[model samples]
Target chain A: MTELLARLPETTAAHLGLSLAALTLGVAVAVPLGVMAARQPRLAGPLVGVASVLQTIPGLALLAFMVPVLAALGLTSIGVLPALLGLFLYSLLPVLRNTITGLAGVDPAVREAALGVGMTPRESLVQAELPLALPVILAGIRISATWTVGTATLATPVGAPSLGSYIFGGLQTRNYAAVLVGCAASAVLALMIDGLLRALALGLERRRRRVTTASLAGLLGLGAIGASPAVCTLGTRDEAPIVIGAKTFSESQILAQVLAGRITEQTGDAVRTVDSLGSTVVFDALEHGQIDAYVDYSGTLWTTVLGRGEPRPGRTELLDEVGRALAEERGVHVVAALGFENTWVLAMPRAQAERLSVRRLGDLAPHAPRLRMGGDYEIFQRAEWAALVTAYDLRFAEQRTLDPSLMYEAVRSGQVDLVAGLSTDGRLAALDLVVLEDDRAVMPPYDAVILASERLRRERPDVIAAMRRLAGTIDDATMRELNRRVTEAGESPAAAAAWFLGRPLPP
Target chain B: MIRLIDVTRRFGDRLAVDRVSLDVAEGESLVLIGGSGSGKTTTCKMINRLVEPSAGRVLVDGQDVAHQSGPRLRRRIGYVFQRLGLFPHMTVAENIGVTPRLLGWDADRVRVRVRELLELVELDADAVAERRPDSLSGGQAQRVAVARALAAAPPVLLMDEPFGALDPLTRERLQGSFERIRRELRLTVVFVTHDMIEAMRLGDRIAVMSDGRLVQVGTARQLYEAPVDATVRELFAAPRRQARLIESRLERGAP
Candidate 1:
């Protein structure tokens, strides 16, 4: 929890920076467009329609969509740019709608008085209409601010460091304290912003100069404090730190910290970890040089990256094939296999397995007709699931998809008879679940391998050499123990990684 | 100082004002009296170009209004709306100083001018100058509107029922003060109102309008002696009947 609190300053700053920048951009674009729409009856409908439509696209998908959009434009797809752009787009609707509505709601008599009093149309808008409409516009800005702050948490998956890091990482590791910190901090930030803006609106409406100035000062001061960390980091460092990527799970997070520790120790280079990335996003980020390196499974590379199906090769041959294909096709270099396979395994509660006499995958076929199964959301959609079904001809009475974290509890509580679980998940032992053997040897190898971007290998061969020392060091038992320390014991991934490296955890 | 030559205004297919020709000499007051939709307001607005003439031309100080931008022309002509139209967001002083400020007057000059105008309208400058329009009573707001119109000291003033929303007593008090201000300033005025009594009291020459055309233009006695039509006679009939009722009540010693 202390470690999580220590991370708050940086993550909160990044979250604030992204949200404020987006809102500022939103105001810049939306206000003028709203004014134009309010004046032009023909334009009002289409202008608001476009913004309303943009808002309807789910926020996370909108953020993810910017990755490809920016990449196509030859701009950086990951990190702050794409996340900021996505948030800016999301903020447009509220501000634009309010601007039009506020202006439209102005008394026609007041508007006429503006013009009648010798103000040009521009002067009327600037001096009279806008000022009168300010309270409503400020209300819209407040809404946009809170919404932007909350949605910014989703920016973590796109490699933008935000308070979302705590929530996503904490959820994967069952560290609710970190998640609570993230949620509470962002909620407080949103409320603080909303309150300041509300005060500003009231001051403007009531024409109280002192209240207006104070609230304005508070808002600007908050923005500057939030933006200071980003501003200070600019142009200060001689070299960019090596970025280590991690997917949204305990094993990936642990392996990432391990790799980060090893590379920093051996190369004496600064390193930063971008954690809680989606599985495919991490790989794509590595390929595009958005990250330096991450740990990936050989089977994931073989099936998802190589786009192969049906044929299952030998374990060693599959590793070589995946490594060669990635290097040739996508410029992602497979450095070394980290001697543990976090493969997909069918597991059942020990007592249930014993009662059903389901000791192997083949043994499950007879009892499968009466049994219900559960797995993580992606398991049923994965290529391995197809291979298993084809090999065993296994059909369950009912199938349910669960989050990987919740799957163990679901099976333990008898919500489902069986679950396709990860081989190295600590909960397997904690919950006393038995793994059903793949007697036919149909499941492909999922050896954990270190993957590096072409840019990293070309620029720093020493980092690669350091990472190679990790190969064959961690076996199945050691990897499972690391996972258990994180998921069950509530230890952080960094601390578990530190334990594995035989170093005292950082204070 | 203000002239409307065959000024015609149409909103889409509906003719709001048709061939309305009128002129106010320097330092003269002309009231345009009509029922609602009778184009008295439209004729008044055409002088300031708030509503442009669909045909013909409006002139102020011998220059065609169409030659100048609407705002530039308006800056030289004072206008007060029927709704009083005080800016709710601005203080009374700010509302009054709008025209002078827009005309590029310095802060000190505009501030001095705002106080003088507020005093000219019989309002306490110190007490009301910093207060917002919403804080004012109906009579005070009406006075502020009048003060705002006279702030820039334009040669021509167009008032569209400036005290229309005020109660009877407040309207009468504002009308009396406005009459004194008009004569004191010797301002050329074009006033629109539906009340025949207000027209008789305020207008040097009353122009009665009906159905988008001028029915008669004359002094109250001249119109009373020679009615152009039933509409013109009916406008005078309401005031005459009210006077008769009040005179008979006083004769009977009623309160």
Candidate 2:
């Protein structure tokens, strides 16, 4: 809580900048396009139709899709640029639709009057038509202002810092306070901005110089602040903070925080985190130099990246081979192999496991046909699942794919008798689940290792050295405890990491 | 002086003004009178190039209206519409000053002319100059529209049912004020209306139109006394007959 309060100013700037810049750009582009569309009715439908389609896309998908689209266009693929582009696209519909509708709604009689009074088409539009349409257009701007504030939070997953950072991090770690703070702050910011827009409309309508000037000044001030490069660049600093990335999961978030905390403590260099990335996006980001480092499991690198179909070797042999392959193939460096594995494990409620006397996969085979199984959505789709089913010759009565965050609760409530779970999930301990042995070793070793891009290894040896110190420090128990502090006790990952390192929290 | 030399206007396939030709002597008030869609408004618009003729030409002061750009020609000719189009966003002063400002008159001159026009239209310059259209009554807005049209002191004026939306009392008062302004300024005017009484009261010569064609052009007394056809006589009497019919029907229903 204290950490969040202390960092409030930076968070507020990021949240405001991304959202406000998007809206400013949206209005700038859309208003002129809307005027053209209004003048040329033939083009209005296609222009508005495209914006409508953009608005219909899911917010997170729209933001994430910008990564590759921008890369192809030779633009920045991550952080504030892509986030702003996504937001600007989303903000178009309301303003564009309203401008068209407002222009159309002006009295035809009044238009004839303007023409009769010798107003050029241009003069009529500027002096009479737009002013009459002001109220409606202003309403549209108000809708967009509030909407962008809330949607800006989703930018975090795309490596942009926003208030959504707090909410997404808190949701993963199950911290309700941080989530509440994020939601409240954004809502309040939206209301304040919306009120200012309303004042602008009133000023225009009533011709009140003071109200109009103040309102315009306020909006321009926000736009100016948002336009400045310092506010618009997410997770960037003058000293160029070492950016750490994490995937969209609780353990990944905690590990990223641990790395950032450790790096900042040891070197006194600034560290910025761009967490909540997509599963494979972190690797892609690192390859493209969008991020400096992140942790990855060897099994993920082996199957997803390398496309190897052979049975896995021992953990030590697998790590060396994977490390060598990554270096040769993608120019990524295996900075250190954190000495803990997070392989897949089949788990069930302890009472249920005891009742069925299922201590191993072979033991569970007889009871499989009578049991309903549950697992994270990806686990059901992975090669490990197919291998285990084939080796054990097991079949469940039903199998459900659920979010990993809810898998423990689903098993605890007997919604499913079994779940494929991660070996190091804090929920496994907190929820008192028993792990069944994988005697056939169908699942591959997944040693959590810190990986860096080749650029980071060659150019910033000091950072790699600091990162290398964490290689063997976090064993299974220590990793489990660190995860527990976040997932069970609702402690922030930075605090847990700080405590583990016996150092003060990084500013 | 304005001359419509066989001017014809078409909106798609329908001819709004078909082969209509007329002349307004300098300082003459020529009222084009007809029922709705009779092309009176279209003919009035043609004088100022608001509606360009599909065939033939309209000449203003010996120059073809088409020779000048639409905006340039319109700036020299005053026009008033039925809806007033008073520019609700601007103050009465701003609305009156629009044409003069467009003409590039000095700001000081424009301010003085705006005040003069406001008073010329019988509105108090101090009380009404800063007020917007919405704050004014319909009659006041109509007057401001006239003042705006007259701002550049254009020699020729085109008005299409300028007082059509006002109440009868306000309409009559505005018509009297317009009559005085016309005589005082010695302006050449072409007024369009469906109202027979307004044409008789204000026009120096009335041109009666029917079915996009002018049926007669003469003084109001001459047209009222002589019958061009059943349509022209019916046009003049249609109002009184309709009113009597409605009154009789209402009295019968009351019993």
Candidate 3:
């Protein structure tokens, strides 16, 4: 436990506690909403359904969705806006359900007597109904508290690191102990909440037994003494929040650093990041409010955003409309597309490419029947890859999508003949794989677009400006270097972002 | 004064109260004497608007009570059901202060009034006031209910078998306290009871009913002296005769 505590940042633990603090807030929100919904059965149907739906959305998807949505609205980790919002929405069902159930379960005669003695609906609720309902409501809160603590740990992946840093740090290093520590800490926090809330519920239960004010006061004093440690502080006066988010790949991390650096120039506020989520996840994050801003590829927005399986439109038209379509439908603003497209670029040994004369997909088609293809897992299923293969009608000897990390070994050992490398990948140069050019430009340009949540757009003009400054700045070489620092240099994201932010990209 | 006029209550197809009416004059304790389902509790609830009349109006101070909202109406009409319904969350004094507190009485005034009501119910003012309803005996809790009912000094009070749960000794003691307090307050009270002896002991005037209809209305002495019908006469005579029968049954074939 001591080693675990020592490894985890105090900053991370503090955010974890504060974010879960919203469990109480969620209970406060849920109880009244639940009560109102209960009183009017018609409202309960839709309102309760909404809370359930919110919980069903996967945590990663929801966090990514909220990022740009909040960036547009200009809220972040500093405001605790998205974290509070997501947790609140998540916690509503249990507290609300319990409140309604508890109130419904109270003896009718007791309720009647309360009303019969001049208790207004409000007074009757506070004096009679709420006291009775508290135990049930608190039980629901216990569930939400456990769930919220568990989910908030994922906030670390999205620049909202609470205790989740331990889990992610473990994932990065393949150390299960780190994940266990995170889970254990969260469970401990949840147990603490359960104990305190149960004590509160029991004290309220025992309130009648201690009729004297002095006894009640003593109980309250003891509770106050007990609660002081669990409270987690949020926001420093000096470092304000600049919101940043990232797409799935390495280059997106570089762009996030670019944005984070630019924002620091304006307000001297430290950036809050939700980084390295899936392409779709990042898009949704911006839409909901988890991330303030993130980088995305033009090709992804074309097919993924438009909901088309194969790329129907050509490269330039797709790129042009990508911005317009995302803004119109998703409320995502694509400020500017950067210079490079990290599109699928098939490569192999230089001798192999030359001997086959495989300059393009069509050029490689005749030889493909005998060649085995190896690439990242996602490229095989991507629309760009699918369309190119179908267009050329090339059938390789065998196609295998390997993890990007294992690609060099797979190619060097001749486990596969061809490499489906990304255009800006540093490994293509480092491993000396021949990058076969796509003569037909079949793959749409995978350019970066700056996104903002509607909240961030209305609220933080400075953050948008800081990110807009990064538009047209990153090219293939610059981003490759940024990735090299992160992957090869063994530098952490914060240090990597700091170094990259200090050094301006060449125009 | 409390008055019910031509009240008729229906529970599904059953006639719980069928055009029955009566008056509870100030300083007069009027208990409705009835069997189960004879509309005695229904009539009492109508005064505080707990159970609304299906057909006629109840009047308190000759003003229509049906128009008063539940909370506003109940404060002026003190009511205690057969089950007591003392808030399990509150102490005896706190339960007593419920009405006065709802009426916006200051803390000091409400506390003083609560103490007086507990004393009126023959409770030790200091000792019993802070005790929880759960901790109290059935009889003591019933007394607390009576104290709570009279806390705001409502001129019109209604009770549905308030001492119905207690044992004989505690029930009689509470009945005596209520009688003496009723004398001192000169309050209009509508009490419900199926117990003929209890009705005779507590009521100045007794309204006897059967099958939801009023069979007779008269002073306690008049009820025993001359009832309106055979059923009314039997209702008055049965309790006194039952006591004698029980006494005889206990002595039957004994040494």
- Positional deviation of B72 in candidate 2, in angstroms? 2.3
Candidate 2 vs candidate 3, DockQ winner: 2
Which stretches of model 2 miss by more than 4 angstroms? A220-238, A261-269, A306-321, A356-420, A438-442, A465-473, A502-507, B221-228, B233-255
In candidate 1, what are the lDDT values of residues A1-507, reduced to their tens digit? 888888798888888888899999999999999999999978989999999988999888899888878877877778888889999999999999999999999999999999998898999999989988888888899999999999999999888888898888877877777889999989988998899899998887876899999999998988897788787667544454698999888899999999999988888888888887777778778877888999999998888778886676899999988888899999999999999999999999999888888899999888888999998867898888988988899999998998677777788889899999899999999999999999998888899999999998998899999998888888899999999999999999999999999843233
- Best candidate per DockQ, number? 1
Which stretches of candidate 1 lie above 4 Å from their native place?
A235-240, A360-373, A386-402, A438-443, A503-507, B246-255
Candidate ranking (lDDT, best to worst): 1, 2, 3
TM, every model: 0.94, 0.90, 0.73
Q: Candidate 2, clashing residue pairs? A: none
Ranking the candidates on DockQ from highest down gives 1, 2, 3
Q: Which candidate's lDDT is highest?
A: 1
Q: How many Å off is the CA of A247 in candidate 3?
A: 2.3
Model 3 chain A TM-score equals: 0.61
**What does candidate 2's lDDT look like per residue over A1-507, in tens digits?**
788777666786778888998998899988888888889999899999999999999898899899888877877688888899999999999999899999999988878877777789998899889988889888998998898888999998898878887887777777768889889888988987898999999998888889999999988787665556454452356565588999877788778888888788778988878878877667878877788999999988888877775767888898899999999998898999888999889988899889988899989888999999998856777877888898899899999997676667788888988899889888998888999899978778899999998888988899999899888777899888888887888787777776777843234
* B-chain TM-scores per prediction: 0.96, 0.93, 0.94
Per-residue lDDT, model 2, residue A251, is: 82
